[model samples]
Target: MARVLTAKGAATRRRILEGAAELLRRNGTAGVSLELICQTTGSSKSQLFHYFPDGRAELFCAIARFEADRVISDQQPHIEDLSTAESWRAWRAAVIARYVEIGRYCPVNALVVELSRTGPEAEGIVLDMQSRWHTLMTQAVGRLQAAGGGCRHVEPEAAASVVLAAVQGGASIYQATGDFVHLERALDGVLSYVGVA
Candidate 1:
C-alpha cells in the first residue's frame, strides 16, 4: 500500500517535484540528476528516496505526470471554453502563442521521449494525457455542432482526433524548423474542415 503523507510531507514532495520539473525544462531529462534535484529542492537523499523508493525511474515518472498536467493547464480558460467559433479561435490563438513562447523546447515532449523506452508507466501517462485532451476537444466540437456553428455531418470524435493529430504533427514540425507557420496552418485547416473558420 502507498504511504499516507501528512500535509507537510505532501508539500515537501510537491516542492521536490516542482523543482525537478524546472530542472528538466531547463536542462532536459538526461541532464537532470537526483543530486541536482536534491540541491535545487533543498531536500536530502533520504527524503528523495522516502518519496520515490524506486529511485530515479520513479521520480522521472512523477515528473512526466507533472509535465503532462502542465501541457493542458497552460492552455487555460480558452481550452476549457471551446464551445463556440469565437472560443475555438481563442483557443487556437492560445495554443499558437504558447508554442511560440516555448519555442523549440517542449518539456513534456522531452520527458515523453526520454522515458517512453524505460517502461509502460511513462508511456501510459502520456497516452492518458492525450486521451483526456482528445475527449475535451471532442466535447467542445459536439457543443459547436449542437449550436449549429460547426459541420453538422462531421463526427465530433473523429474531427477531434484529426485536430489532435494535426496539432501534434505541427508541433513536431515547429520543433524541427523553428517556425510557427506549420502549426498555424494545420490548426486553421482543421478548423476550416469543421466549418468553424
Candidate 2:
C-alpha cells in the first residue's frame, strides 16, 4: 500500500513540485533534468522517487495537472461570476492581464508537446481543458440571456463558441507577435456580433 505523508512530507513534495515547475517553465520539459530539479529543490533522489516512483514521466504528469489548474485558476473570480454584465468586462480584462503577464509562456502547450511523445494522455488533457473553457463561456452566455442582456435573436451556445474561439485564436496570435491588437479585435468582434459593442 502507498504510504500517507505527514504535513512536513507533503510540504517537501510541494517544494519539489514548485521547483520542478519553474525548471520546466524556464527550460522545456526535455531541457529539465532530474539532477537539476534535485539540486534546485535540495531534495534527495530517494525523496524524489518517494513522491514520483515512475520518475520523470510521473513528475511531468503532475506538472501537467498543475499547469492545467493554473490555466483555469488564472481566470479567477471572473470565470465563476460571468453571470453579470460587469463580470463579462472583468473576465475580458482578466484574460488580457493573464496573457500579458504570462507573455509567451504557455505551460499547457509545453506539457502537451512533451507528453505527446508518450501517448493519448496529452490529447486527453488538451481536450479536457478545451471543454472546461467552453463550459465557462457557455454559462456566461446563458447568464446574459437569463438577465435579458443578450440580443433576442442570438443563439447563446453558438455565440459562446465563436467568442471562445476568437479569444483563444487572438491569444495565440498575441503570443507569437507580442501585440495585443488581435486579442482586442477578437473581443470587440464578439461584442459586436452580440450587438453589445
Candidate 3:
C-alpha cells in the first residue's frame, strides 16, 4: 500500500516533483541529479529519500507522471470540449503552439529516456499516457460526430487513434528538426483521411 502524506508533506512532494520536472526540461534527464533536484527544491537528502524510497527510480516515475499531466493539461479547454468547430480549431492551434513553444525541450521525451533505465516500468507509463491521450481524442471525434462535423462513414475511434499516432510521429520529428511542417502535414493528413479535407 502507498504511504499517506500529510498536507504539508504532499505539498513538499509536489514541489520536489515540479523542481525535478523543470530540471529535466532545462537539462536532459541524464543531466538531472538527485543533488540538483534537492538543491532546487530546498529539500534535504533525507527528505528526498523520504518521498522517494527507491531513490532516483521513484523520483523519475514521479517526473514521468508530471510530464504526462503537463502534456494533457497544456491542451486544456480545447482538449476537453470538442463540440464545435471553434473548439477543434482551438485544439489544433493549441497543439501547434505547444510544440513550437517547446522547440527542442520535450519533457516527455526526456522522461521516457530516463524511465528506460527501469525498462517496462517506463514503457508502461508511456503506454498509459498514450492510451489516455487517445481516449481524449476519441471523445473529441465523437463529439464532432454528434455535432455533425465529422464524416458519415469514418470510424471515430480509429480516426482518433490515427490522429494521435500522427501527432506523436510529427512531434518526434519536430523535436529533432525544429520544423512545424511535419506536424501541420500530419494534422492535415488526419483530417483528410477522415474525409474532412
Candidate 4:
C-alpha cells in the first residue's frame, strides 16, 4: 500500500517537486541530481526519499505530472469558456502568449523527452495530458458550433484534433527557430477552417 502523508508532508513533497521542476526548466535534465534537488529545495535526502522511495525516476514522474498540469492550467479562463468567437480569439491569443513567454523552456516537453526513453510511464503522462487537452478542445469546438460560430458540418472532435496538432507543430517550430510565425499561422489557418477567423 502507498504511504499516507500528513498535510505538512504533502507540502514538503510539493516543494521538492516544484523546486525540481524549476531546476529542470533552467538547466535541463542533464545535470539534475538528487543532491541538486535537495540543495535547491533545502530538503534533506531523507525527506526526498520519504516522498519518493523509488528515487529519481519516481520523482521525475511526479514532476512530469506537475508540468502537465501546468500546461493545461496556464490556459485558463479563456480555455474554460469557448462558447463565443471572442472566447476562441482570446484562447488563441493566450496560447500564443504562453508559448512566447515560455520560449524554448517547456517543462512538460523537456521532462517527457528525458524520461520517455526509460519506460512507458513518461509516455503515459504525455498521453494523458494530450487526451485531456483534446477533450477540452473538442467540447469547446462543439460549443462554438452550437453557438453558430463554427461550421455545422465540421465535427468537433476532428476539428479539435487538427487544432491540437497545429498547436503542437507550431510550438515545435517556435522552440527550434525562436519564432512565433509558425504557431501564429497554424492557429490562424485552423481557426479559419472552423469559420472562427
Top-lDDT candidate index: 1
Candidate scoring better on TM-score of 1 and 3: 1
Model 2, residue 9: C-alpha shift (Å): 2.5
TM-score of 4: 0.85
lDDT of 3 by residue, 1-197 (tens): 98999999999999999888788876776788999999999999999999999888888877787888887787897888876666776777788888777676675566555554555676677778878888998888888888888576778789888977777778778777888899889987876665545
Which candidate, 3 or 4, would have the higher lDDT against the true structure? 4
Q: Write the per-residue lDDT of candidate 2 for residues 87-184, one digit (tens) a residue.
A: 77777788788877877665555555554454466556666776787788778777777877757687877887898678767866776677899988
Using Cα atoms with residue i matched to residue i, what is each candidate's TM-score against the true structure?
0.83, 0.80, 0.81, 0.85
Off by over 4 Å in 2: 1-3, 111-117
**Per-residue lDDT of 1-197 in model 4, one digit per residue for the tens?**
97788999889999999999888876766778999999999999999998999998888788888988987898898877888878888888998888877777665456456645445786688788888988998998888888778888889999889987888788777767888899899999888877788
Model 4 clash pairs? none
Provide the clash count, candidate 1. 0
Candidate 3 positional error at 135, Å: 1.4
The residue-level lDDT of candidate 2 at 182 comes to 92
Runs of candidate 3 exceeding 4 Å displacement: 1-8, 26-28, 111-117, 195-197
Among these predicted structures, which one has the highest TM-score?
4
Give the whole-model CA lDDT for all candidates, comma-separated.
Answer: 0.83, 0.76, 0.79, 0.82
Candidate 1, residues 102-135, lDDT tens digits: the string is: 7786655655566554478988888888888889
Rank list by TM-score: 4, 1, 3, 2
Lowest-scoring 10 consecutive residues by lDDT in candidate 1?
109-118
